[model samples]
Target: MEAKLWFILLCSVVALLLYVIGFWRRKAGEAAFAAARAAATAEDRDRYCRLAVMAGHREACKMFCLARSDFFEDHRPLEPFKSHGIKVVFYGYYYPSRYTDLLNEEQRAFCRSLYQFKEGENHGIGFFKACMSALKLDDAPYHIMFMPCSDEFKYARRFKRLDWYIRTHRKGRTSGLYDVDVFEPRDSLHEAKGGENRILERNYRITGDIKGKQVIIVDDVLTSGQSMADYKEEIERCGGKVVAAIFYGKTVSVPPMLLVKAVVWGGYIKTG
Candidate 1:
């Protein structure tokens, strides 16, 4: 009886060991499969999956198309301005990498034809010109507003540089200059000792009358749309109707609430 009991115990131990090993192998295989599936999904979503890293512009257009399609499925597609009798405007920044050097000789010339500012001009001048061109309102009588979301002090330094440059180079042209506006949502909340979870308040100050006017909010990149959302809220609060929001580049993830009217991509190739 004692020998039989010992034999039974040994067999039980062997069985338990085998079961544990098999269980571990199965778990590992499942985990590996899950990881592979996740990777494949991510690759499918990424426009630059098979393309080289430097070919960002080429991939950016594809990503924009995908995002546009996704956006249209959930929300109404942007109607043509001609039908609505709405004024079309374009706003953008002068990214040298995007227009000047990114293209071949012919393409570079073509972009230059549309470019108002000269090559290697101050960034602020380029930005102002680009905004005017984008809006299609170069000759139209309208107020210009500058709403920089950056820190006041940091932007103050840039403004000072621009101020000195403008005063020295283009005298008398700085009179009707940007109605300066600042949006410091993050920093303001941080200073108040607000927790990270606290929703930041949208603060805005408008120099001109925005009531019953169609406004076009312009930005460089369309990311989480949080900044745009804040801007839209403030603009509406100040009685300005946002006709459209234009962006130079559109990222993969954009918030649904912030509707993007138009996006221009593939205008730049990352040489670096």
Candidate 2:
């Protein structure tokens, strides 16, 4: 009992410390960013700008974008897996190996920015264009939808930018597509962990119509699959059919399949 109490106290202290640090960092970041804008010397300005970015300032972070062509590799298929009785497609594996760890991290960061920022829309469109070319969704009555985020602004930005790319890019890919907007957020809620249980026990309300449409959920990563399962159940409960789930990658310690595929494609990751 004494040890447990001590552990609890330690955890609380750590959490409080982290919270305080985060608050300080945000303030520092904003100030540094302002200083960078006002600095007369280029060196001092660059230094302050870097500090702001490192401190996680929103505007400062925007000035920097992660894009390295070498990070591009074969992304998709994953042998047509299933999640909660719905077909799933994993475009790539978000793994960092010994040989190409930095590249992998940069690649993951760039990929994540797809849904997080508007600039990523172009990349996201091309990324999906390649995936769409690879997929024979001719027979599937698919409607694009993203993994529902309670943050309405983020969700709205994400789907709006990426969803219509296929439709506008070419005539063939626009056969029977719709922006599946059956659901709307009630209020903001923290996205807690626990995957399925977290989703099942959430406080925010999601109201939707469904209309018996076949949904294709787009997400950044595919992890333990429970979250998708919960999403699948939620979609079903709301009266829509989950035809497929598309992802940028699956998280893994070592991406054996990705390496194998890369080699078979007549090339490997060029570390140069």
Candidate 3:
């Protein structure tokens, strides 16, 4: 009986040791991840602030001062505004709510004055409102353009979190190749498909009275930039000047020249 008891005790001790080792390793891993994330956040914050400064946005200095902590968490990097004398607008996909209450009246006025665009309904304009509110900014004259990219459907499927469709369709000839072909011909096809005002239900809503203004086009990513080109043409036709364009991510291939200026991070990092 004593021998059996000794064996049981030994097994129990080994199990406890194993559990302790696993727990320690898990904690260490979590700590390492946290450290890396913090470092990345700091890097992104510095890059954003530097870009804003380079763009000659005096308001950026104050905006960063008020919202640096939150900005760090958001992981958005800033791009230098190309136009020297004109107002440098910081366009983004969505605004975060946390910044609303933090902004002073003057800061709020500035945000309000800036032209802003949200991509789509699902892209989360509410978050922008939250950020505005947190910054204590009142409503500005912002235009919300809801242009859903034609490839958005395919891109959504390609990069979906749980890709059951991809798995199921693996055996069959994939739609992936078709998407590639479409993208290749996207420029000419998109141009023929009504060009600028094709997607606009009421182009007058956003296009009216934009004449001679140095409009900065903003989007989440810049792959082929065909969509941007279309938008730029439309804007120009409506008497708006396409001074610059900014995207969260950039591609290496040919970019649309109409933008005159552009900025992007090479790879993926959450901007909105």
Candidate 4:
């Protein structure tokens, strides 16, 4: 009986030691993650933010989403505006480089992150996906299409997120992903970036049957209203009705003070 008691006591002691080790290890890990998240520079935060986001840390994930009311709050949805004639809904206005400097440090960092996301940064896909949620689109059997790309979208990560958002937004109930065969242009139309809009022709052949479908057009930025106009015409020409067009930002040429006034008018700043 004493031998059996000794064996049980040994097993219990071993288990207790393991539990204590595991507990302190977990606490140490959490402390390390917190330190990384609170790093002074965005560059440092970015290095660890990826690991936190992948680990599903809620606070760390907040950096990659604009769902915060104090930041990129939802605007009045589905309001028609501008000359394009499509219902334009955007998260916020994108300012020029000089104007961007006026924002506070955190806000400026976010703006930089957004541009980085646009330039095909992989870890920034969450921001793009969060932008898509601003449209308040209902699961009413609507189709999704991205604007035509001459080759694979220069921002291919953002393109794939567009597809992923719609499909999972309502749990497997949306599709009509905008894909097109890359039409070799006559020459490198560098001006496709803007300054000369519709004069340069794009030979994008949209695929699949979008006939009689209500399509939602997705794009990075809406500027000059020309690319969107062309896409709208193409979808209509193919018998698809564009119900709404959503963008990450609309180019606004406001002076710095006016932009600051607009944000102040929003009453979205956090004070604690």
| Each model's lDDT | 0.41, 0.55, 0.38, 0.57
Residue by residue across 1-272, what tens digits does model 4's lDDT show?
A: 99999999999999999999877755554554575556677556544543444444444344433222233433332333545787777655554454442333655665576576466563433544454455566666777787654455553555665566557754634555545554564332322444435463666777778898888777766656677788899889988898887766655433233333344333324321
Task: Using TM-score, give the best candidate's number.
Answer: 4
Per-model TM against the reference: 0.36, 0.48, 0.26, 0.54
lDDT for residue 45 in candidate 1, whole number 0-100: 30
lDDT string, candidate 1, 1-272, tens digits: 99999999999999999899877755554444334323434444332321311222333333333334454332221221221233322222122332232223433443343231212232444544443445554332232223343455543443444455545654332311244455453353212332224564545456566776655554443334555566667767878765555443332333332222122223223321
Q: Where in model 1 is the C-alpha error above 4 Å?
A: 1-124, 127-131, 134-138, 157-200, 207-216, 241-249, 252-272
Candidate 3 residue runs with Cα over 4 Å from true position: 1-76, 81-121, 126-148, 151-218, 224-226, 243-272
Better of 2 and 3 by lDDT: 2
- Candidate 4, superposed: residue stretches over 4 Å from native: 1-83, 98-103, 122-138, 153-155, 185-200, 255-272
lDDT of 3 by residue, 107-126 (tens): 45433433121222233233
Give the better candidate number (1 or 3) by TM-score.
1
Ranking of predictions according to TM-score: 4, 2, 1, 3
Candidate 4 Cα deviation (angstroms), residue 213: 1.1
Per-residue lDDT of model 2, residues 141-170, tens digit only? 565656655544656555565756656755
